[model samples]
Structure formats: C-alpha cells, structure tokens
Target: MTTKKQKSNSESHERKGVKRFESTTKGSSMIEFISKSETIFLTSLLFVIRLAAATWGIINDCDEVYNYWEPLHLFLHGEGFQTWEYSPIYAIRSYFYIYLHYVPAVIFTHMGLSKITVFTLVRVALGIFCLSGELYAYRAISKNINNTTARLFIFFTMFSSGVFQASSAFVPSSFCMAFVFYILGAYLNENWSFGIFCVAFSTLVGWPFSAILGLAIIIRMVFVKRHILAFIKISFLSGLCIGLTQLIVDSYHFGKPVIAPMNIVLYNVLSGPGPSLYGEEPISFYIKNLIVNWNVAIIASGIGFILSLWPSIGRKNQKGVTEYVSPIVWITATTGLWLLIFWKTTTQRRTIFIPNISIYCIFHCTYL
Candidate 1:
C-alpha cells in the first residue's frame, strides 16, 4: 500500500511544515507575515490623522446638518430642525444608527461633558469605527495577498480624503462606508454571519440604498455554496432584526409607526418622477468625479485588470509558488461592476463616495 508517489507526497508535506516552522523562527514570511508593531503604528497614525480631520473638516453638506446632527441634537436637547428626509410624513431616515453615536453623546453631555468635548468624543469614536472596518479590510487583504500590497493599500486608506471625510461626516452614506469595510472583509473570509449582519445593518439602519454594495457578496455566497435557501434565511433574519429595531426607535421618535427602510425605497426608487428631483446629469459626471478623487488608483486598477485577464502574461515559472490570479480576477470584476453601476447611473457626491471605497477595496485585493 505504500506506493512511491504516496511516500514522496508525505515527505513533501513534512518538508513544507518544517520549512514553515523554520520561516516562523527566522522572522521571515514564508508567505506573508506583517509585524504587530507596524500594524500598531499604522493604526495609531490613522486615528490621529482622522481626529485632526475632524477638528479641521468643515461641515459642507446641509444634509449632514439636518439628517444627522439635527436629529442627534433633538435626541439630546429635545429640539432641533427637521428636513424633508426626516419628515414624519416620509420617515426616510432612521434614528437607530444615528442613536448608536448620539445616545453616547447624550450620556457624556449629561455626565458634565461640554458639547464641544462630546462632539470631539463622537468624532473620535466614528474614526475608531471607521478604522475598525479598515482593519478588517487590511486583515482580509493581507491573508489573501502579498504583505507589501496590503500595507500599501493601508497607506492609501489612511491618507484618503474620502475616508477622512467619511469618518468625520455625519451622513448615512459616510456611516455606511464604515460597514462597507467589514462586509468586504467578511465576504473574502467567508464569515457568513458577520457579512450578513453588516450588510443588513448597513441597508436597514444606515442607508437602504447601500444594499447595492451588499448584493455583490450575497450573490457570490449564494452561487458558490449552492445554498440559496440558507443565504435567504440568513438575510431575512438579519434584515428582520435590524428593520424591527429601526422601526421601534424611529416610530417612537416620529410619534407614529415608521418603517424607515421601506419609506426610503419608496421615496428614492418607486416614487413617481424619482430622486432626479434633486438633480441629474450624464453618466460622464461620475467619471469626472472619480478622476478627481482617485486618478492614480484608477490607473493602477486598469493595470490590474489587464494582468488578471491574461494572468500568464506577466507570470513566470516559480517553483513552490502559489498563484494569486483567481482572486485578482474576481476583485477586478467586482470593482469593475462597482464603478459601472455607480458611475453609469444618475449620481450625487455622496453616491460617488462608494467608488472611492470600491477603489480601495479593489486596489488592495488586486495587490495579490
């Protein structure tokens, strides 16, 4: 029963295990091992930079005033302005995710903290949340790609204006970007529970429109595992839990029953004439916007896409090497789809934010 091939294969596996242990002792990556010290330094730098941004980044959007800060102010002081989006008539905005930030603000404020102090605390908290998402992104990318590539994209995310803004701004789009980070990471790692929770939370509480991003992961899981019913069950349960929490909190606040997610879908999509009531432009608008935000990343993504199509084009024979073309191909396709959908449709600046997030995700994923 001890065939020559079997003995050779057993010896090969033993050799690999020994080599891996040797590499571990030598402090060299047999594959990819990023140092804990470097990760800590980068994380600290990200927090400090985002905090600086919070202190300096002026509130630019009126929606940030009405939809987030105002609601938060009301939840604290019992009086704040409202907007059409938060109108009791429409209930397009949910207070559930908003409460996640401001309820703490209220507590701290009640505990003798100044508004300015509590605001800083809130910003720091948001930065930490955003950083958490990026940490997941980093882990996902590092586990699947070259360590150097993972570190480089970490730099990109740490320095990105969009990311800084997202961390500092009090909008659902910005907040959902935080969730987007974890969802992508969980998708790659096949952590179905976390992936479903994040997707559901983002869509149900942060922004219903964000389901667009979640759809990518859902499709992949459903198709790959050939378990459509399982995914549906998970999604339904997650959505029900998140949606019910939002309905309760928002209903109490609005003084009526409110299914905010459904209202959001009705207003933004199913309503007659559509959200074009705000503005619309040719698809070229988002292309121009992306060029402004991420020109270099876009160029690099094109290079990655080309490399993925003909993986052998740039690859060479390397004994004992593990190839990374398949993941790159999938990342290329996902990022391509992200860009096409966000850019080809009617758009706004907040809508454009997803592209920057996608670019970061693709850039890191392709680094494999």
Candidate 2:
C-alpha cells in the first residue's frame, strides 16, 4: 500500500512538471518584446515611407520595364515590348511570375482605374509585401537575438536608398530579396518547414539562383539539427507543388511543356556564353554601388563582421566540431560566397544584397 501511494505521487509530480514547462515555454514565445503601440507606430511609419517610394520611385533598370512590366502589360493590354527571353524557343522568363501581378492589374482595370493609378497600386502592393517580410524579420531578430538588434534592423531597412528602390521594384531579384527576409526570419524562429517552403518558393517562383542563399539553413537542418528526413520531405513537397504549377502555367503559355526555372538555371549556369554575354564589370563596381547605397553602415558592418569572428571562431559544440559555431558564421560564409560568384557578372546589383543589409545591421548592433 505504501509503495503504491508513493508511485502515484511520483507519477503525478512528473506530469505536473511537464505541464509547467510546456506553459512556460509557450508563454515566453508569446511575450511581446515591444509594446502594441510601438509596433503600430513603426508599421505605420514603414508603410508611409514605402508608399511614398511606390508613388514616386523611378524605374532605375530598363530590365524592370521590359522584362517584367512590359510582359505584364502585354498580358493585360495586348500590346507591349517582348524580350527575346520571352520567345517560345527560349521560354526563359516564367509567365507564372508575371501572372501574379496580372490578377491585380485586371482587377484595377475592371475598377476603371487609370493605367498610371493601376501602376501605383501594383507598386503599393509590392511595398506591402516587402513591409510584411521586413516586420517578420524584425520580430524574428528580437526573438532570436535581441530587441536592440531588431530595432537597428528596422532603422536600416526603412531608410536605405537601395531598399527604397528594391521594395517596390517588379523584378525577380527584388522579389527574391523580400523572400530572403522571410527565409531568414523563418530559420531564426526555428520554423523549419516554413523556412524550407520559402527556400523552394523563392528559388522556383522568385529567383532560381537564390537557392544558394538558403544553403546555411538547409545545411544546419540536415547535419546539425539532424532533421534530414523533415528537410527532404518538406523540400520535395514544396518543390513539387511549385514546380508543377510553373510547368502547367508556363506550358499553357508557351504551347509546350516547359520548366522556366530550370531553363533559366541551365542557360545562366551551363551555357557557354551565360550572363557574360550581356556585359561585365570590375570588382570595384559592387563596392562603389554599396558605398553609395549603404554609406558608413557598410563600413560598420565590416567591422562587426570582424568582431563576430572573435567570439565564434574557436567555438564548438558537444561533438567538438568547429562547424557548430554561431549561425551568423554560416550565414556570413554563404553571403560571401554569393558575392564572390555574383561579382564576376555584370548583372549583380546592390538590390541583390538587400537582405544582407538587414544581416549587417544585426551584426552592427550585436557586436558593436
């Protein structure tokens, strides 16, 4: 009888302990780092600024006008410039991407809005998408790193000239930049499935090359966290869904089965001429561009990178592997690899590094 009574009490205590732990973890995750009013005020400020950019932002790249807006215009108005890439023979550009903007244009046209107003509204929609990604990243940084770093990230993203340009641009690279914010946020929040989906969606739907940017997260999931099965399962499912949708939509438009993302990747990566056929710039090109857009923040970030190295360089986990250092180290490595690869081409721009600017801001606040 005494043994039975003690066993019952021990089992009940264990159950209560587990429940307490579950509640504490849940409560901590829900705790707001910033007050509600502050969130509202910051959101309003970002939207107003993004709205202004949408209303007045210049089409800095002719590619934006021809490759995206023109194709979208042709889809809606039945007449617009069509680049060689849109040829049925090449089918390099995905009509599915254009289709996303098309639905809104159709709606605005039906509403009797002017072409210019429709244009502004479309850009405004891009701004909202960009803002949501930024805010999510901000929250993730607060939750994963620190609130101060999150605030600094918001400040840099809101005011940077490059962000002002990229936030509303109608280009795959710009779309990739916004998706990257979501990817980073998802990874930091430890939402592995969503992060994997973002990687697949961004690569297949937004920019094919951006799969490289998500490598760190994928690597950590497979090797470090030992979530290889989940990674493969989520990646295959997301890729299948996104890839099939692209094939269906693109095949309908091109008059044959087509995988536009794969085609672009093969052309850009495997072809003899590749992107170099267009033009090439010296390494100085990207440096001057970053200096102009980010100014001293770029230098501060460089210093922060060095500072980050000091703390994480020799760190290792239980397995005694150097690869177990801070996640920032891995992120930094992939980012540097991206720069090395992209700088060799003329097509690379400051806009491609918009998410990196957020990372830089995090480094600046965390280390400096």
In terms of TM-score, the best-performing candidate is: 2
lDDT of prediction 2: 0.82
Model 2, which residues run further than 4 Å from truth?
1-34, 313-323, 346-351, 354-357
Q: Model 2, range 112-135, lDDT digits (tens) per residue?
A: 999999999999999999899899
Q: Which ten residues in a row have the lowest lDDT in candidate 2?
A: 355-364
Q: At residue 243, give the lDDT of candidate 1.
A: 80
lDDT of 1 by residue, 1-368 (tens): 89999999999999999989976854665234567777788888887888887887777788888778887888888888888777788778887877898767878898998878888778778778888888887777676555666677777787777787777777787778888888878877768888889988887877776777776566666764557887889888998888888888989988999998888779767785556776787777766766777766676777766755666434432333343334345434556666676566575545556423844555644643
After aligning candidate 2 to the native by TM-score, how far in Å is the CA of 284 from where it should be? 1.1
Model 2 TM-score relative to the real fold = 0.86
Quote the positional error of residue 246 for candidate 2 in Å. Answer: 0.4
Cα TM-score of candidate 1: 0.85
TM-score of each candidate?
Answer: 0.85, 0.86
* Model 1 pairs in collision: none
Per-model CA lDDT versus the true structure: 0.73, 0.82
RMSD of each: 4.6, 5.4
